[model samples]
Structures are given as C-alpha cells and as structure tokens.
Target: MAATLRDVTTYDLKLAAPLAAGFVLFFVTPLVILLALSFQTDPQGGHYGLTQYVNFLGDSFSLGVLGSTLWLGVKVTVLTLLLGYPVAWLHQRSPGWARGLIMLLVLLPLLTSVVVRTFAWVVILGRQGIVNATLSWIGLIDTPLKLLYTEGGVVVALAQVQMPLMVLPIITALSRIDPNFADASSVLGAGHWRTFRKVILPLSLPGIVAGCLLTYAAAITAFITQSLIGGGQMLFMPMYIYQQASTLQNWPFAAAISIVFLVSVLVVVSIFNALGRLSRGYANA
Candidate 1:
C-alpha cells in the first residue's frame, strides 16, 4: 500500500508541475506585469503614485464612461440571453441535420475576423446602408435616420458580434437535459409551461449564467466594435483605455484603468458564481 501511494504521489507531481508552471505563465505573468506598470511613471512624469487610480476614479468623465460601459454590458447580456435561449431550445428540439446547419450558421461568425465583422456592421448601419435603405424604401422614414454612431447602433453591433459566444454554451447545456424527464412530467399532467418552469429552466440555469457572464465581460472590454460603431462618440472603458495608452501616451493611467476593468469583471463573475452555487443548492433541495 505504501509503495502504491508513493507511485501515485510521484505521478500526481509529474502531472501537476507543468500545469502549475503553465498556469502561472498564462494567467499570472500579465497580471504581475500590469501591477508593476500601474505603479510606474509615464512620459509626462506624473510620477509613480496612486494618481493614476485617483484620476481614473475621481474624474466624472471616467465615471461616466464606466457607467455607460456597465449599462452597455447589461443590455448586451440581456439581449444575448433573449436570443440565445430560443436558439438553444430550437437546437435541442431539432438536434438533427437541421440543428447542425443552424449551429453552423450561428458559429460562422467565429470563423471571420472581428475587424471584418465590425466593418460589415459599419456598412449595414451606415446612413446609406442596407437597413436605412430598406426603411426608406418601405416609406417608414422619408430620410435615412441616424442609426450608426449611436447607443442603439452599439447595442445592436455588440449583440450580433457576441451572439455565438452566448449561444454555443447554452445549446450545449440544453442538449444534455434528458427528454424523458420532460416526457414523464407531461404524462403526469404537468403542463408544458409548468414542466419548463420547474425542470427545464432550473436545469439550464448554469448555462444561462455562464452565457450572461461571457457576454457581459466581452461587451465591457470590447474595443474594435465599440470604437468603430460608436463613431468616436461613445466612450467605453476599453476604448478609453486604448486612447489613454496609445493616443494620449498615459501608460500608467491606462494600466490603472485596465486593472479596474479586470477587477470589475472578476467581481461580477465571482458574484455570479456564488449565486450559481446557492441556486444549485436551492434547486437540488
């Protein structure tokens, strides 16, 4: 028994050491670098101090950007869930060749570059673009409305781009639910809505929470789509950070903002995870 235990311990160390090193390199390395840079001086010699954080936290403009970014995140998350749930249900219900085709269509965006996707939105949402042209043709509006470069445009663009990320996980989760459970509930005289409410929804909560978390985090830090679609008017935290770091040459402050965004995402995900745990316990009970 001692010999067997010794071999198992040796095998575990062999498996864990490389994984631990890779984890540190992949996750810890950048965090260490960012923390160091956040305390370093920039070209303006603002000095190594909490001034960067203070400037980020104290400025109303920055606060407004943070608020807008948070709101945008929430909107995108909700919209994704709204669309993703139905699509996931469809995939599960069909789970056939049609489902594969539908999934392929849903995930096709993943194969394309984000820049290309954003540019596509620019074309579609432009003043003389497909959407406005269609509206004008139908006499819905006499003139091309200002659709591009607005909050609405940003929301739509973000939703379209982050959709696949939301749908895939949900469909995966939904497909795993045993249909027999639903069948049994229905045969027991539980109506469709009741079965869905009591069984299907509760089972899928993990996936829904996961999808929401992914969409929210991606929406908050999204730079390319936000920058292009927002038309330099909207100020998301990620774009603001880019402007500060590259355009304004304020590395320290940029680093601080980056750290702030990172912390915010971590906190949000942590809260969701805690809620997820409590929800699982409650549902199981």
Candidate 2:
C-alpha cells in the first residue's frame, strides 16, 4: 500500500482565519447596522421603509449631486492616468538607480498626511499663490485667475495626492512584460510609438484598469479634499451625505445616500473588473 500525503495549502489556509474573523467583526458589523438604519422611514427609528431612498431618488438636486460626484472621479482618474503613465514608462526604461529614485518620488506623496498635501495645494492655488505669482512674473496675466475652491482646483489636488496609486500598478505591470517583445517589434520595422501602442499598451491595460478603479473610488469619496478645495458653495456626494447626517441630524436619509453612493461605486468597480477581464484576454491573445 502507498502512503498518502496531505495538501500543504490546507494548513496554510487556516492561518488566515483570524483576519477573516476580524473583518467580519469590524467591517461587516458596521455595514449591516448602516444598511438597517437606511431602511428606517425616519431618523427617530419609529418606522421602517424605503421613504429615504424614495425621497433621494425622486429629487433632481440629489441626483445631480451623485452625477457630479461620479464625473469628478472620472476627471481625477483621467488626469492621474495621463500624468502617471509617462512616469511609470520612464521608470521601466531607466537604469536601476534612476528607477529607485523615480519610485521614491512617486511614493513620497503617500508618506505625508493627505490634509497637509491639500493645504499645500490651497496655498499654491490662492490669489497670491505660487501659480499666480509665477504667471504674473512671466507677464502672462494682469490679474490672478481663480483657482482655489473650484472644481479644477479639487481635481488638481486629488490628482497629485492620488498619483502613486496610478503609477505603482503600472510599474508592476510594465516590469512583468518581457523586454524582448519590444525588441522583436523593433526588428519587425515597428517604430517606437507603433511598438508601444501595439505591444506595450495591451499588456498594460490591466494595470490601467486597477489604477483607475482605485483613483476613482478615492477621488469620489475624498471628503477632506473636496471640502477644503471645493469649499461649501460646491457640493459633492460625500459632503451632501455629511450635511444630511451631521448638520440636519437626518440619519435615515444620510444612510440612504450613503447606500446609493456605495452601490454606484460598486457598479463602477464592476465595469472596471469587466474591462480588466477583457484586457487580460486581449493581452493573452
């Protein structure tokens, strides 16, 4: 009779039980409570129904807030991708020392507190800020352009804060690709841009999707960045939810908006997952 051996991974899987239990205790518990709260017809918890969700869905202004929040995420993600991809590509092509330096610079933003970074942007975008001062010195403008407390300002600040999320994954993806593929393309008479578009880009789409998903989620729900950069006059979903819950003491409606925003984000994430799957197939093909 032959002796049977046990699977090693079975023992390894047991090591993660603590983490799984902790996630259930901390994350799932609060989420379940929030979901329960959202169904209440009033903040007092006297009744339970979909009144809050109905009120939010039926209102035009509420819908606009959600729409604008999603659009803002799109702008920030696009801007970060456009700016970060070049940096990642450069890092991939650089010497080892240069690559290390580039990675350090990319990660430096994450080391600092986000509030500190947002405040730095506030200073930079002020009327007497670096941007205006430089432009004035260059004789480009007679007066300072309005930069602070605007959508443009919020997008710029969020992009800078979130740049690492966009860059790091692309770096990982690019590093995995075989360098010989590029050489083969070149040997086949493909120019640099053509080789990149045909070979490098398809291989990198999974990374791009991951980066976009992360950046989009962060940008949309960034309460501090939105509040500081956009100010009170402009409203996003995060702030709208805050006002309803904190200011007005309307927990049911606030919870409802939170659920709507959460579902909207999940839908966006699912679309990204689909894109990621398609990109993986294209890359494999």
Candidate 3:
C-alpha cells in the first residue's frame, strides 16, 4: 500500500510539473517583474517612490476612469447573466441536434477573433449600419441614434462576446442537477416556477457566480472593444494603461495602474465569492 501510494504521488507530481513550470515562467515571473517596475522611477528619472500610485489614486480623472471601468464590468456581468441563463436552460433542455446547433452558435464567437467581433459590432451599431438603417426604414427614428462610441454599444458587444462563457458554465451546472429533485418537488405540490426557484436556482448558484466573475474580469480588462466602440469618448483602465505605456512612454505609471487593476479584480472577485458563499449558506439553511 505504501509503495502504491508513493507511486501515485510521484505520478501526480509528474503530471503537475509542466503546468507548474509554465505558470511560474509565464504568469508569476512577469507579474513579479511588473510589480517591481511599478515601484521604480520612470525613464526620465524622478525618484523611486509611491508617486505613480499617489497620482493615480489622487487624480479625479483617474478615479473617474476606475469608477467607470468597475461600473462597466458590473453592467456587462449582469446583462450577460440575464441573457445567458435563459439561453443556457433552453440549450440544456434541447434535443440533441438542437443542442448541438445552439452550442455551436454559442462557441462560434470564441472561435472568431475579438477584433473581428468588435468590428462586427462597429458595423452593426454604426450610423450607416444595419440597426440604424432598419430603424430608419421602420420609422422608429428619422435620424440614426448614437449607438457607436457609447457605453450602450460597449455593453451590447461585450454581452454578446461573453455570452458563451456565461452560458457554458450555467449549462454545466444545470446538466449536473438531477431531474429527480424537480419530480419530487412536483409531487410535493410545487409548480415549475417554485421548483426552479427553490431547487434549480440554488443549485445553479455556483455556475452563475463563476460566470459573473469571468464576465466581469473580461469586461474590466477589455481594451479593443472599448477602444474601437468607445472611440476615445469612453475611458477604461486597460485603455488608460495602454495610452500611458505606449503613447506617453510612462512605463512605471502604466505598471502601477496594471497592479491596481490586478488588485481591483482580485478584490471584486473575492467579494463576489464571499457573497456567493453567503447565499449558498442561506439557501442550504
């Protein structure tokens, strides 16, 4: 037994070796470098201090950018959840062929490049694009409403782009739910809605929480979509970081912002996880 256990442990270590090495090499090393850079002086050489952090936290413009970025993340997460849950439930309940088709449609966006998808939104939301033309033709409006270069456009594009991520987790959670629970609830005089509310919804909390975290993270870090759709009118943290690093050549400040962005994501995700745990505890109780 001891020999077998030792062999199993060895096998597990071997299995994890490549992944561990890759993580340290690609993720941890770069992050350590970024953290170090965040503390250093810029190329012009002022002083190695908290000047960047102070400037970022103290500036009203920076604060506004951070607030808007966080707000956009929340909006995108909520919108994705609202749209994804129904689609996931339907997909899970679908027949094999229909399920396959739905899954294909859901995953199709992931297969396409994000730049391509954002550009597609650009075309769709543009004044001369399909939405405006259709609306104008239908007499909904005489002039093209401003969709491009707006938060609405960003949210719409992001929700569509991240829908698959939200739906996939939800479908996984829904699939894991036993049909027997619903049947038992029905036998106990519960309707479909009640059964879903008491049984299915609680059970699916894990997936919903996971999807929210993923969607929020993606939305917050989104650069290309914000850049293209927002047209410099809207500001997000990632775009700010890019502008500082690329255009302004302020690497230290950019790194500082990046660190803040990382910390903010971690903090928000932690809060969400805690909320999910509390909800689960309440449900279980």
Question: In terms of lDDT, which candidate is strongest?
Answer: 2
Ranked by TM-score, top first: 2, 3, 1
In the range 27-87, model 1's lDDT, one tens digit per residue, is 8998898887887656565467777788888989888888888889999889888987898
RMSD of each candidate relative to the true structure: 2.4, 1.1, 2.2
lDDT of 2 by residue, 1-285 (tens): 587887765667677999999999999998999999999999889799989999999999999999999999999999999999999999999999999999999999999999999999999999999999999999999999999999999999999999999999999999999999999999999999999999999999989999999999999999999999999999999999999999999998999999999999999999999999999999999
Report the CA-based lDDT of candidate 1 relative to the real structure. Answer: 0.86
- lDDT of each model, Cα atoms only? 0.86, 0.95, 0.90
Candidate with better TM-score, 1 vs 2: 2
Best-to-worst order by lDDT is: 2, 3, 1
- Candidate 1 shows a clash count of 0
Q: Which structure among the candidates has the greatest TM-score?
A: 2
Task: State the weakest 10-residue window (summed lDDT) of model 2.
Answer: 6-15
Cα lDDT of model 3 by residue, 2-95, tens digit: 5543454344568789999999999999999888888876647556888889989999999899989999999999999999999999998899
Candidate 2 at 108: error in angstroms?
0.5
TM-score of each: 0.91, 0.98, 0.93
Query: Candidate 3: how large is its RMSD?
Result: 2.2
Q: Where's the lowest-lDDT run of ten residues in candidate 3?
A: 1-10
